[model samples]
Target: METISIRAPSTPSSATKARRSARTRLPAAIALLPTALVVLVVYIGCMLWTVRLSFTSSTLLPKLDWFGLTQYMRLFANDRFVTSAENIVIFGVLFISGCLIIGFLMAVFIDQNVRGEGLFRTVFLYPYSMSFVVTGVAWQWFLNPGLGLQKLVRDMGFESFTFDWLVNQRMAIYTIVIAGLWHGSGLTMAIMLAGLRGVDKDLWKAAKVDGIPTWRVYTSVVLPLLRPMVVTATVLLATGVVKLYDLVVAMTLGGPGIATEVPAKFVMDHLFERNNIGLGTAAATIMLITVVIVLAPWVYARYVRPQGRHA
Candidate 1:
């Protein structure tokens, strides 16, 4: 029997493909190096620094001395901080609810093929385009008792008209809610409108053929389909609720005596005004914790659970 020499097939093609992939990826990796460094240094570094500082008794500056949870103890005990936590909860609830309701309604209205659709969308989104500082200032002027709506109404011989929520200690936080709604509702509307446009036209036709009312169709079919958009809008609105510093600073200054105070403003006051870095970081950490607690469940439901199902 002639022994035939058997040779292994060359692996050059596989090796070449691997080499090509590396070459293709190298430039992209090089391009992303600066962003990775910035994120590691600026964001992660700052977060770690804040957490470390929260355990200290630093005053006027960041001191590396470990002081346990004294700052957190003080944070919870402080009336202003407690009030800020309460105010944020109330404001967050009202703001999110108002935005969802008003935004959904506006989106539905706009989806009706009304004339001047572009103009209406622009007008709705105009507030979001304006900076918070500008929105706050304009709203401040508009809500001012002596100079704004109340004054104008009073000048019209309705001396009994009163709209002094901006000055009332108990009601000042609600004014923040109103301004927040005005600034954020447009964004939610835009998100909802995009979701609406993506819905299959066949679904609308099916609903009509079944003699389902428009509102019923929205409530039954379209609303469920818009879950992802609602989640997106809620997250965006919730983020705005948490970092609610600039609007409150410009509009209310956390007053009528800390009635409208929020966690972000509380952190800023301790860090800068009160010269208490430990307390500031502690407040920030608490805010971070609160946000995580609120968002973790939603994140798990939306992303992690779906991934687990596939796995």
Candidate 2:
């Protein structure tokens, strides 16, 4: 006896699924297109335009004349620009380091399950919620000699007290650093606290079993685990350092004879106040280059290198 084989009919479920997926994705694609276009047109386009302007002799009005590296050369030679660059370097180093140290300590303290943890966390993180302008203004008043700390101290019979960094040329940049620490440490603390909270309890127990000192455990084991958080906080702080305009404006206005001038303020002065667009754009380009150079290694290590290794 011969037996015939019977085959089941193919269903259109795959085709139906594909059609459903396409229908669902179309709206999302449509929604994203506008944002994509805006980024391309607004951000990338403006960046390119600014860079192009940097290479021109544009002043007062954008002339678009080929000026080559004249603007950069001029920018480097400018005393105010040089001073601004130096001030920024000082501020960045101190601010980043101070924020990390203070933030880590705060996070560690809070991580001990201390009483009033909520209140302490709120107090620490409160400064971060305030705008840089507000922080700057507050710090400016607090550090003022005649009307602030110095006066208050004098009122307490300490007539020789002098806390005049805001108006003191040599120490003005440090005041900015202090204000930055106040404004930024809170954010860094929050980041560090999150990282600390994410650490496995088993590791702590193992460290305890191994008789590792608390400081050693933190310095050796926990710090290594918190590297990502440190990097994140550094990046945020570095961005703030780069765009440090509002704070300086509110506090010092690049005062004490250009002692606290920063690159962002330099750019703004040239672009708007001084009517030197070429110089401004050149400074802006340098800033952009600096940021790119700083971030490239991390970006490659974090994103590109992993893909290459996987491949």
Candidate 3:
């Protein structure tokens, strides 16, 4: 057989192609420059400033006196700070799990050819649109022994009824968890509902053909496919957990002898009210460190790993 030599068509040189691509991308980058500048000036600038303040002996205003890690040492020794850390972990785990579970159930129920889907969806999602300030007040009222659950229960002739978790020092944090679940579960449900809707109807048909149970199909099949949405929910919940402040302040005021105190509240109180900005910044630093430590591994696993295609 004679070897056939085929001449390739002429192509642009690498430098010429690179220049052309850069010309196209230059306008897009120019458009994005304003947004980049805003983020650098605002978010990143404030974060650096906050980190700087954490190392200073500031009080009532931002002062810049080198205090080393003295504030952090004080923070580590404080029992209130320790308690706040503990409460945050408990609240975070409970709030996230409660929201996901309840939200999944609600979403699944609503997804079933139910009557009045819009009304049910609205009823659940309306809570997400409302301010936490309002939610906290409603929860406080509902949990109050004299005016809410206990009073109602007692009036029903069960005079010895006692459902005063909001008053108990050990249980007040749980009340916050309950309120947080109520506030967040609605959003979770909406997310899960959207995920459920996007799932292939073919999967359900195949599952039914194979005589697989509906519940198993959900837990094993649909839920696995919804992993991205679940991850989204978890990250959102974790951020909210870190920023837990207004809810606790509104619900319990961190009262009953600092029974339900959380890290955010601890930071806010000392920063503004107690006039101990140094110590407050120290607490804030600890919170930031904790977040970095907890999230770093997950971030690395999720974003910094090489993908492996299956055989």
- Across 115-190, the per-residue lDDT of candidate 3 in tens digits comes to 9999999999888887888889999999999999999999999999999999999899999999999999999999
After superposing all C-alphas onto the true structure, candidate 1 shows an RMSD in angstroms of 7.9
TM-score versus the correct structure, for each prediction: 0.90, 0.89, 0.91
Among residues 3 or more apart in sequence or in different chains, the pairs in candidate 1 whose N, CA or C atoms overlap within 3 Å are none
- Please list the residue runs of candidate 3 whose C-alpha ends up more than 4 Å from where it truly belongs after superposition: 1-13, 307-311
Deviation in Å, model 1, residue 103 alpha carbon: 0.9
Per-residue CA lDDT of model 1 for 93-125, tens digit only, reads: 999999999999999999999999999999998
lDDT of 3 at 47: 70
Error of 2 at 156 (Å): 1.5
Among all windows of 10 consecutive residues in model 3, the one with the lowest summed lDDT is 1-10
Candidate 2 residue-wise lDDT, 250-294, digit = tens: 999999899999999999989998999999999999999988998
Is 2 or 3 the stronger prediction by TM-score?
3
C-alpha lDDT score of every prediction, in listed order: 0.91, 0.91, 0.88
